[model samples]
Target: MDITQLVYFIKIVECDFNLTLAAEKVHITQSALSQVVSNFENGEGILLFTRKNGRLNELTPAGHVLYRYALEIVQKHQEMLKAIKNEANKLVGSVRIGIPPTLLRSYFIPFLPEFISHHKNIGIEIIEQSANELKALLLDNALDIAVLVQPAALNKNQFEEYSIRLGEYAAYMSIHHDLAELDKIDWSDLKGYPVGTFQKSLTSYHIVLKKLKHAFPKAKIQFTSTSWEYLLETTKDSNKIVIMPIMPKKSAKQNYFLQKKFKESLSFDIGLYRPLKSFYNPAEIILHGALIDFFNSGIMK
Candidate 1:
């Protein structure tokens, strides 16, 4: 039987043939409770109660068996809740989350230490996937949270999004490239040159690439391996430029030796997301809070 039916059944047994009293206790109508209990009895192929008055009657032998099991089930459920609350108080759990490699550099590295510090008992597992992949993982319950650009490019109903970073995006060109000689290049320029890019399949990257492709229809494009390290390697020798959102001075830096100039000025949304059910759990709450605080305060000194 469903929890609703079980609850009403338990109350009816406790109230002992007083449908009004049981209904009052459960805050449901007597008819509703009676119909639910009757349905339960019909489905179980047994008489649940004896109808002496027009209300809840006495239990049959089968009814006694069902009541005992129901009470045990209810007590076990209460114990389960108490155990979960105790675990929450201890702050001991593992949170598995997904982050886009495309944006992880800008988002994760700086925030990781603080998250670990704030919730020492919460072990974190990160699955590096494209934003699109992360979305599916979240919907399927394989991931607890995802760091992505925004909810607009995704199925909004599947995710609860919160913007954590608001920053400008820049197109990066090799210093030796001709475009680098210009003070600034407009969207219409760079049509004939190769442009370094991240995975076009990614929602955020695809959104930006759409605009760039519109501006430079003839531009040759190359996708990076979705790491800052590889992005920097492209800058060292390749003439192609990669678009990036420069981190604030406080972000964790890998190597700051390379010079970055503003190529084309643009901006995009950045956010953290999880399934709505995730917020109800304590482990997710702590980890989510840690990530929120990590972004609110700078992660790297």
Candidate 2:
């Protein structure tokens, strides 16, 4: 009936109807939470949850309907409060951002100094994890924004996305490697070579692994790492072919590695992603705009 009850209801559902867990999350006693839900059901004369053997089983049809509306109402309520607070406080809040390890230094960190300089009042917290991990944190509402290498099969409805750059996977090898002379490397060309690439936590790893397996069923994946430096070092002196996003031209030249695109391009878009329903405070809005502008200006190129 009230916003507090609605919040409790949403948390209960999100916790899979576990009253104990929901109570813990909301910092209340289990018996008190149970009594609140019982009172709400009694007052409204509605059976919101189905119970079996004195344990919550699932939401009733009416509960499902209420859950949907509750989410919208709570989000709007929070947004209203944030808007008022931001107006009174004036552009001061922390923004929690997630970036994958592989793209941290190469893609995002270069723009931070300037962004921080411009918004000295805003505090920025950076979380470095793999792309898969970042996605999980975003879904759990732990990250305000994430820099993701947008996969081909991304669920567009879950997040609002702004494409920053378009790129594709490429093969890297020592300059003296046999395939280094070729402008583009075919999947079949790596038949006998040991392969190295990003760890399974990255979307790129799965993309490249699938293509490599399809093209050569017996291909050997000898090394898997989250560190690009490790991959580069592993490939520099050995016969291992590293498949990853195309590195900066300067890095490739200095590292003495040849970059060759895949004959069949494995492409992706690097973008900023935020939960579609989440409210963005002033700090987050400014940070989002700054990131888009930074990428659009082509300073990283």
Candidate 3:
């Protein structure tokens, strides 16, 4: 029988076989409740209760067994519904987000705590990859959302982008390096020094390397790494120069390195991106908003 039928059976058993009291408790007419139980008894071809003076007096042997199973079934069913409702009411789920190593370091790292605090129900899985790799993951449906650097002329059909900020690149070096003393520098000045860049898969690395090579074809390119730890170490070596985006610095670990303004800026746009026409879970939507708010708050300034 269905849950409602089981519930009515349980109510009648608990109400001392008094049809009027059970009907009132379950919000049904006594005659209707009696007919329902009568139909059930007839359908099963078993007497569920004994009758005296045209009133239900006591349960039969079959009635006791039915009552036990019906109570358990109805209670368990109710608990299941309550559990489902609670889950529906809360924003609870896992979200996979991709971000380039540079943005994760300069922009997203500092603001992560506040974002998590606001959405405790959302579990975050941060996938660190190059911007192009992030885009590829989005296309493969391997990532829920990503923060990427968009080229000036973006392909609108590629993905849906929510612009966050515009930024550019500059040279960073150890304070002891002679180039650090220059208020501003040009690409030609980079010819003699060892240049360290992010891996080729990174958008920043591609942008910086193209410009640096075009101007100084003979530049000493010494290192290429995906790890920020290694890149920062390269900068502190007092001889090597690292070219990276001109976003706000979050860690003082890079304090030993000085940033120089470029005579001609190498500009890029940064934003949150998602697969085109893809559906987002509740957690993903909240996180997307948090990323936009974090950018607008000038935390990346």
Candidate topping lDDT = 2
lDDT of 2 by residue, 1-301 (tens): 7888899999999999999999999999999999998998999899899999998889999999999999999999999999997776564889999988767756765678878887777899999988878888888989999998865244789878888998677888988899978988789999989888888877777778888889988666778998887888877767888888876665556556778898888887888898786577888889998989888998767
Model 2 stretches with alpha carbons more than 4 Å out? 1-91, 151-158, 277-279
Q: List the residue pairs that clash in candidate 3.
A: none
User: Candidate 3: misplaced stretches above 4 Å?
Assistant: 1-91, 152-158, 252-255
Lowest summed-lDDT stretch of 10 residues in model 3?
Answer: 246-255
Alpha-carbon RMSD, each predicted model: 15.9, 20.9, 10.7
List the candidate numbers ranked by TM-score, top first: 3, 2, 1
Instruction: Report RMSD for candidate 2.
Output: 20.9
Query: Please, what are the lDDT tens digits per residue for candidate 3 over residues 225-256?
Result: 88767886877857888888764654633557
Candidate 2, residue 57: how far the Cα is off, in Å = 96
Clashing pairs for model 2 are none
The digit string of per-residue lDDT tens for model 1 on 151-252 reads: 546566876888887756666655566665576667666565556666666654666577677776654466655666676667655666676666546542
The global Cα lDDT (0 to 1) of model 2 is 0.84
Cα deviation of 85, candidate 1, in Å: 18
Better of 2 and 3 by TM-score: 3
